[model samples]
Target: MSSFSADTPHSSSVMGRIFIYGILLIVAGYFLLPLLVMVFTSVKSMEEIRTGSLISIPTSITFDAWSKAWSSACTGVECSGLSGYFWNSVWLVTPTVSISTFLGALNGYVLTKWNFKGADVFFSMLLIGCFIPFQVILLPMARTLGFLGLAGTTTGLIMVHIIYGLAFTTLFFRNFYVSIPNELVRAAQIDGAGFFMIFWKIMLPLSIPIIVVSVIWQFTQIWNDFLFGVVFSAGESQPITVALNNLVNTSTGVKEYNVDMAAAIIAALPTLFVYVVAGKYFVRGLTAGAVKG
Candidate 1:
């Protein structure tokens, strides 16, 4: 009876684990199935795509669609492909991410370590920026861009992203820094470290996880931004997302699903790569940042 009781609990635990794993597998498949179908479609020839099922494996795979999507696909008058817009996104995202992350870190350090008068009120006001609807600011932003002579320019797009992105980045860094021990900052101050000195020497190094989180968050948001890209940029300054839209919507020829899928895959690769590489730090940062000091 003792042995049976012990065996019964073990069996129940095993069954519970199996049930959880089964549910996880089902959820994973639900998300991955679309990706699998997209990959299959991207590799298949247009004829095969049209005749065969979306989930069907291609009898013969071709990379022509990928090549075309990267090098020769049309977007409006430009038939040279997404290469330019891809680079445009790179240009826009690189600076925006760097600036936003740095500012967020700085803001966080000040808000937490410095703790001047009305700091919470200031932080609260800044947090409000995050909740403001993008639509509400679009017209004002456009006019502001025009006033600043940055309308329809890459610079304009960069400014727009930076402005909107600051709130979230600031919030992230603030929350993360709040969890850090104040003793560290106090000790640094006692040792004669000024604001920038303490920040450069102490805070910045410890902020790696949150910085990674902030960078990935900002990069993903800025890279995937379509509304701002389409509205703020024009001509050669348009980002990849806008270009992809134009490529997909161009009415000159039969809709090429393969090319569209390839372009989408290409467009999506950078963010995916970033996440895959830094996802661990991202999750760790979230957990660590959630802790209150």
Candidate 2:
């Protein structure tokens, strides 16, 4: 095929392109305005903030808000800051994403490659799980957590997220795996590979794109979750989301808007970093998986 198709006309005139780009730029700026305001507010002193408009540029930049937000901001009477909660979320997200992705991969592999008497029914149940409202499960989940002695603990929170997120992870990988040809599995079996061996040597190696999708998806959900974090965990065990809430909404006589903004940005930094680095792959992976299933 020729690099340029002479028979095909260009989709739009140059002016049309300019109009499209102009609209896109306007929309982008509209969405990014909050972030710009946040950055400006976080850097400006309270005096400047009081005197200046919300969107005005700071004449003097200071990171004191960022420092205080990270370390000594008062959350009610306790002033431990979000640093501890940040690390708690890190530990929580790491294992949850890891375990959920692995198990979801296994579920996908089995449901797609190995036919069982009730596989369709089982997968449908999982699909149903994806649509179940988070609110509906709260009471039941809390009761279950209490029964298991994991209530008000980070470990309990991890289990809750993993269970809730499993359906999504499984659906992603299953859709992706259905696109993979079953012949690959048969050939490996013909070569005397066992189930675990086939999964380890073949399916796993082929699962990179879906794995990235699952990780990014699960990471964002678990890291940003406030309802679960607040409901299931206590003081030291709370995730950054819960702590950020405390920092922003406490009954301090003087509201530290700058500190609140910085704490918000800090809490958001990990998800932002993840999306910035791997975001392009996220959509590509979804499309790759969506091709067959």
Candidate 3:
């Protein structure tokens, strides 16, 4: 009887471990299933894809779709697949991210360390702008851009992202700089450090985490931005989003689902890569800079 009692606890521990491991494996499989399917589908021949079950392994694997998506798939009379748009997106997003991040850091510093009359009012107005839906201002922005002769240019798209990005970036950095002690600023000031000096030299270095967060957020948002790209950019200036939409929506033919899916996946690759690479900093920055203090 005593021997049985000793064995009973050991049995329960083993059972508990088994249950936990089983649940974890099931959850892992559930998450991995869709990714597995996409990879399998990507390599499968079109005939196989059309005929086979989604779970079935590819009878023969090929990189035809990838090659087509990169260079040959047609959008209208244009045979250049997604290569041009890929470079276009890189051009637009780089400037937008850099300029917006710089301005946001500036706004954050001023709002946090250097309070003056009407600062609250100004901050409130900016915060209010954040909640305003993009759709609401679309017409006005379009007209305004058209009037400025800025419509249909990469510059226009960059400016638009900057405007929209400012609100969130400012909010991010302001809250972040707020958590930072003002004594640092005062110390810099006592040493004859002016606004730019303190901002450039002191606060900027410590704010790397917040900057990473801001960059990642703005990069993803601006990179994936379909509506703005569609509206603000036209002709060759249009980003990959526009090309992607064109690719997926041809007027006079049977929709190529395989090409469309492949294009979509290719378009998503850069943003996905950005997140995968910087995801740790994204989380760490937000947690440390925003919430910890």
TM-scores, one per candidate: 0.90, 0.92, 0.86
Q: Which window of 10 residues has the lowest lDDT sum in candidate 2?
A: 284-293
User: Can you write out model 2's per-residue Cα lDDT over 53-145, one digit (the tens) per residue?
Assistant: 999989999999999999999876779778998999999999999999999999999999997899989998988887767889898888998
Model 3, 1-293: lDDT tens per residue? 23355734543566777998899999999998976776777677778888998889888888787778778877666878888888999999999999989999999899989998898889889887776778898899899999999988898888999998898788888888998999999998999999999999999999988898889888888888998998888877878888988887867465555566678888989887977898886676445434532
Candidate no. 3 TM-score: 0.86
Name the lDDT of candidate 2: 0.89
Ranking by lDDT: 2, 1, 3
Residue 144, candidate 1: how far off, in angstroms?
Answer: 1.0
Candidate 1 local lDDT, 1-293, one digit each (tens)? 23355734443466776998899999999999988987898999999998999789899999999999999999888899899999999999999999999998999998998889999989889877876778888998899999999999999999999988887788888888888999999998899989899999999999887888888878888899999998888999999999999999999888999999999998999988987888886665445434422
Clash pairs, candidate 3, are: none
lDDT comparison, 1 vs 3, better candidate: 1
Best by TM-score: 2
